[model samples]
Target: MKKKIHGFIEKIIENDIKKNNQMILRTRFPPEPNGYLHIGHVKSIYLNFTLAEYYNGLCNLRYDDTNPKKEKKKFVNAIKKDILWMGFNIKNITFTSEYFDILYTYAVELIKKKLAYVDQLTKKEIHDYRGTLKQKGINSPYRNQNVQKNLDLFSKMKNGFFSEGTVCLRAKINMSSSSIIMRDPVLYRVIESKHYHTQNKWFIYPTYDFAHCISDAIEGITHSLCTLEFQENKKLYEWILTNISVSNYPRQYEYARLKLEFTILSKRKLQILIEKKIISGWDDPRIPTISGLRNKGYTPESLRDFVQKTGFSKQDSLIPLHLLESSIRKDLNMKSIRRMAVIDPLLIIIENIDLLHCENITVPNHPNVPTMGSRKIIFSREIYINRDDFKEYADDNYTRLTYNNEVRLRYAYTIKVTRIEKNKKNEIIKLFCIYDKNTFKTQPKNKKISGVIHWISKKNVIPTKFYFYSPLFTIKNPDLEKNFLNYISKKSKIKKNGFIEKDLPNNISCIPYQFERIGYFIIKKEKNKLTTCHQTVSLK
Candidate 1:
């Protein structure tokens, strides 16, 4: 389904702009470059950028790099790459650090107006004073620092006079305010550590609550959009900009973030998984990070299409994980080429091979699309079929191979099973069959063969690896669990060696192959070369 641009926020933007003749619809995608961007962030990026495009307004890709302790250059680079890969042409790139001087001026202005004060409370003291929802907070003892004294102390702190965690600047809002976030949220904190962008230029850093709205106002952003989790912080966001006397402050709007089922989008939890070595780094295909999904061969078109299908809404809901899978399946079904692969190989030898010569079958790459072209597949006397396709003894309803039962081999002749050989463990090792040439593209004349199977010519097959992926967690709602790692699936991945059609295009990028009767498989790369093929989804 195509996504429609009909959210209430869009309407609000249009109406507000029309009401104010001089106003413009400018927006920003402010991502804190602390970790790799996940699918949850994708929705926000799409919304902000698309809204700006639809309104013929300016959209900036700004990094809210306030927390120097967690921000990094690598994460920043990864973020830029992810956005570009998703097909967004971001014209303006800005950073909060770029406006550090301006933001510092605003903070000083707040202090001069007696709306903000430098606090000497310890970290725990601050938290304990910040009462819970049922209680009212208490003002910090140092909240009354005079303008001149506060200005000197704040300057010294910024000039590296104060040690980290000794003091912080706070807003002078009412302690008894009903909005807990308005009860004097921290505006700036002293951090002696170096930053990726600023290096050791300063010892103090502005907090997100202070910097976010101030930066938006400084850039003349018309709509300050964020996820609903920050609904409480909207009060503080407005307070900072209003108290600073900014000429035009952006209005903040909150929308529900993507909470996908069977997936966890919390960067902290994802870090834990990486530190614990539960899966590979952030690009592990099991996780839903943009890089992880890209590694799993998800197309940017599919991602954009998926985002569009889930229209903007204020309500939060857990979307089924299959909705994402369905998007990729829809795209691949039309574009992906077709081939035959047999994993868990069972060798089948034709009994009358001396009489029945081998043949070549020209099969279309796509069953429904002729322009996709065709690939030549060998139909030899000896071939490898999937072990699951055959049974030593079967019920009448079995649609696949059984002893003495004739079955149709996809794109080739029909074969009658004659015998089955077993190993010492009583496992079926091999199959012997006879081909009926008259059933090449049609069923038998006398009766119908219910069984239809897929095979690869053993003589002309290339052994390949197939990675079968399952849900990362055993349960659907692992995010709600106390310890999501407890539900990590033991069988999340199944590795099988298969024989695929020989001479598949080498050195080609992530092209999906439909393994005849099997599911779609995308090539897995090792240093930009094909290493194995991963099954994207099951045929069913």
Candidate 2:
């Protein structure tokens, strides 16, 4: 079934279809490939691609790789891989560099029409002249240069005659206009750095504001979708397209961008984390990058569901991180195989059973999913359980293991703790327990066992490392701080030794598993004699 489209953007598109009758909707996701894509970009990707699919239209993935100073071929490739990982099979992949010749022609057309001029103003001078929101901008002295002279200068700028930042092509728009973006925005600038795609082919490149609208028009895009931050720039987008000779003029619409709690999506900030070695890379599970979440075992379905629930809106708001966690939890609950793992393993010896005895117990892979089948787990005289599951003393409300208390072992017998062994420091080392042989599927006569704990036999267990991830930032909105790095969580990631059922596949693959009482986790890396699993979310 086609997903119902009912956002404000959808209303606009529906009205446009009604007005144009036969308009074939076309949208594009234009990303500047300087860093890995984060969850914020996923929202845009979901919106554009899903809208196109729903309207029986098309969406294109375009790289707005105009800034050669930071953009790289590696980033371009990473962006493509991330999109594909999100299950978007975009065939119309393109780059702004591909349309450089035509963009240059469009700039020349604007210059010849006295709509653009070559400015020799320094960077600071241009910034000073642009004016703030409270004050109107002053016109540049070069604003009135003749079309012939401007054209000669622009050609020279493009031909590498001008040094970087010395010359730029600015549109001849109103300087005193209420919109600062329309106050003669720079259309092109000279950059000496070699572009990843077109190395040294041209000395000048178009700014995003200039190249974006023209690129949309050139590609015959009917609806240009953007975040609300671009609302002020919409006027410039329209003005440039209106002045250009393009056959098609795309309309720009703005919606709220994703502002996720506890994480900053700024590429510059993320890069800083990388440069400081604060994270392994962009894919560090603690961050919100798409690859990071994937590495943490988040499914594409959950991310798409998150975007859908976030919805489209005109007003900006910060989305709670739990909303995303809830989506993934709901998804993993249905799909993940159930297994028993002990993060902080505590030894428990069943005294009644023979030390050499081992029994095979059958457990469903997924309790609700019968078709998922079942696996046999070893039940031996000695087993391991999470230290958190056992308490030396507990209140009546505590249902987990306690000294002299009986608790049901998941898919096994009910066990009663007889005693505990402690180290010299008073830390509990292990527990000695006795199991009721007949309580695997029933309560012991005249007694109720409300607590059920997961356990793995000490025999044939896979030694594993577990990573517990918390929010990268300590505050709800780290972006509010002048230096977001100050709010970095000291314990964002905690690693510990653990054990998983021996029945687990040798190659666990990327699929996550519900670690019974612990949490959902997926195999992250495997080395000789040890496997590493990353926690996706806690059982709660």
lDDT of each: 0.85, 0.91
lDDT of 1 by residue, 399-468 (tens): 8988746788987888888887889999888888998877778875696787678888877787778888
Least accurate 10 contiguous residues by lDDT in model 2: 523-532
- RMSD each, Å: 2.0, 1.5
Clashing pairs in 1: 399-451
Q: Which candidate is the best by TM-score?
A: 2
Candidate 2: the clashing residue pairs are none
Q: Which 10 successive residues of model 1 have the least lDDT summed?
A: 522-531
Residue 206, candidate 2: how far off, in angstroms?
Answer: 0.6
Alpha-carbon TM-score of each model against the true structure: 0.96, 0.97
